[model samples]
Target: MTEIEFQKNFSQLQYHLYTSPLPHVSNLHPHQKTIHAFFMLDHLREELQRKNESTLKTVNAKDFNLPEELHVYHSLYPLDQRQEKSIKIFGYPSWVYKSVCSVDGRVYCLRRIEGFRLTNEIAMSTIENWRRIRHANIVSIREAFTTKAFGDHSLVFVYDYHPLSQTLFDKHFSSSSLQANNHPQSGGTGVVVPETVLWSYITQLASAIKTIHSSGLAARMIEPTKILSTNKNRIRINCCGIMDMLTFDGGKNIHHFQQEDLIHFGQLIISLACNSLSSVLNLPKSIDYISRHYSPDFKNVILYLLNKPTPTKSVDKVIAMIGPRILHEINSVHHYNDFLESELSQELENGRLVRLLCKFGFINERPEFDMDPSWSETGDRYLIKLFRDYVFHQVDENGYPVVDMAHVLMCLNKLDAGVDERIMLVSRDEQSCLIVSYKEIKNCIDSAFRDLSRRK
Candidate 1:
């Protein structure tokens, strides 16, 4: 068989395979799965379009007292609702803003440390080392520089922007009790995060820390507020390399810092488990809570990280303990990949149909072609006109419009595939008719389009 014929048969087979009812599986209708997949893709398209539009939208710079330019970045908009003095983490009152990079026209998250003086010029060089560190769970830092545009001496660090992302603290701890109270999984005790989800977080954090330590650097900040949830259960370590720049001492104690990273990692997890940042203060109660709620492996992982600093205690040890959990996370990732590929296939089909429709819109009902008034009314072009009417301008016996979407889709699909199925095309006057196959109409469209393009 020809390629077109083979494709047509294969498409039919695939449709049947997806839609066919199976007695062994369950009692489901033939078209249920197909319709669900179609609508799921439709919703996904809408979500993606909204996100893209939101990212591309620019706010009025005049509305706020914003800087016109800051080292190749412009159009700065404050991400925080209120510019409260938050000196807990960075020691300096920091502000986050979304700005467009003038050089590349891409948006980046600019973290400005307000009134931070550059005591040592070597501190700025630490960002270069961070620029080399890239991992899936780490929000890669672009660059850092000092600017006086904000009416003060400010140190700015550029990082990638994830639209509509929330901090781990904001999503979980800030309103943990409310979410847990409303959640069906939580039996109303509040702050009941699932053990599996905690495992996922543990594995992802370990992976990121391993990458950081391997690059001869350390993730000095690993708090809930410093991590962002870009999507559901998907997180990335935010504000990396800022501490190194802020606390730049001439003598470097990489080992001590790395050990502090482990301790902080353990405390973050404990705080998340106990549903309070103060959980680290009372280790006995927190350990008892973890013991009662979580598995032994999880408890052991926490215990290992919370232990006193030693020569052998490292992120590698944590990884070795959670080996099977890491495997489970990988398996989940593979399943998610499969689901995305299936959704992507549906989108590919949509893109093809859109192109086909665009081609029809370009060729059909031309007012004039090659300066010939009767060009579209004569020869093969006339057949295309009749085919358009057959697809869209259909009427019933009572002269009422028949708005059948299924018929329109079927005709378009057949035309795109160039199938051998023939149909009768009637003129506007109803005095003449011509029989032709989709394959012939397809050739007519190509020939007419090519003929039009060769002009001038």
Candidate 2:
């Protein structure tokens, strides 16, 4: 039936039900109600198809198989692949067929499923909308296809293959316990990595969300598992692929993008930070120390729950207390600068002391160390070790290792040799010891190390 006629019939059915005297409409037979609901849903789908057809028609079939140069960044992964054997992955239902493709020498995932018939036009429109959106964190779509067979339909979406990256839940919650047990020294340490690394991930995640917001789209799903990172600096978000699936089934109802995205984004941040804190502090899952301390609203919710008259009052209060403490521990550097200054100073003091061979024009305006000082203690240790290895060479002094003037000048050419730029500057005459700055140190260390690694 035509969309309008179907809608009219569905509305008439709804009107009859609403006008019935029985408040509880359970008197209807189970099979009859089931059939009624099924037709109503079908009619709604038809109406949506009619409404979205014009927009979908604008999406050309040729766009799906565009040449490499003509394809957008999101379409690159899907277009370059030579289809491989089907595989099953977690998260999705078992019925969905999956394949792997090598695009630009990188593996990309392609999922094909039948039963949910999507028009080529609709698929193309979704791809087009995705192409215009750009974010550092969000994974770009590679390509999409739709096919129809005798009464059966299938849709395929191509996406960049992120190796060694799992959903946040998989990474933090599922794997952390096993990792903590197996590699107690590294992963089991109560300390998290430096704020720099954590902030790097957070900033990328926020930027991705911001991009989605700007594109007039909302990432309905924002969680750890959706956030992906390789060993490299790049982070890829898997929202577009999931959103495409939802839109294919007429589930894209984003009337309030900002509100919904913001809520989800907040939840994502809270979840990650909470999980990190729980792992590091050995706290329960529900207690989010970081959010409770940083977010007053969340804190209030916890407090209200704790105030309930129950035997678990003490336990609830303690859990509530844990969240704030985690937040405090992570963010405590904001209130005090001594810890960072001392740590940076110690790194410079221990590393090789590079004296100015000849007084070249040194700037009157010194370097700035304005970045956040609050880093996980483990991060501090890594930075220290990084300085010793790349920037400063250890020397034997009176039968003991010491960093002195000679070591500094010898390491001058090697200054900033590592990724963590922590350097030690000394005067040629060995009189002045001016710690240049942590920022300069990290830059010098990183550069020197990077160049050395590249040479090898």
Residues 79-150, model 1: lDDT tens digits: 775546789999999988899998998999999999999989988888888899878999999999999998
Task: For model 2, state the Cα shift of residue 3 in Å.
Answer: 49
Task: Give the TM-score (vs. native) of candidate 1.
Answer: 0.87
Model 2 misplaced regions, further than 4 Å? 1-107, 147-153, 175-197, 232-234, 239-241, 248-252, 276-288, 291-456
Question: In model 1, which residue pairs have backbone atoms overlapping below 3 Å?
Answer: none
| Tens-digit per-residue lDDT, 1-456, candidate 2 | 333543343322232233222244667775333212212234333444443331122112233432232221223222112234232222333121123343354345554454455444554676767767666567777677654421345555666554344455555556565376342332323334334444445445555665665576666556555566643334667747555553554334554433554445445544444444234334233344544334554444333433424433322233343454446544644543564454345346333433221111121111321242332112332343334433344535564546554444435534434333434544434564444445565454444334333632
Best by lDDT: 1
Q: Using TM-score, give the best candidate's number.
A: 1
Clashes of each: 0, 27
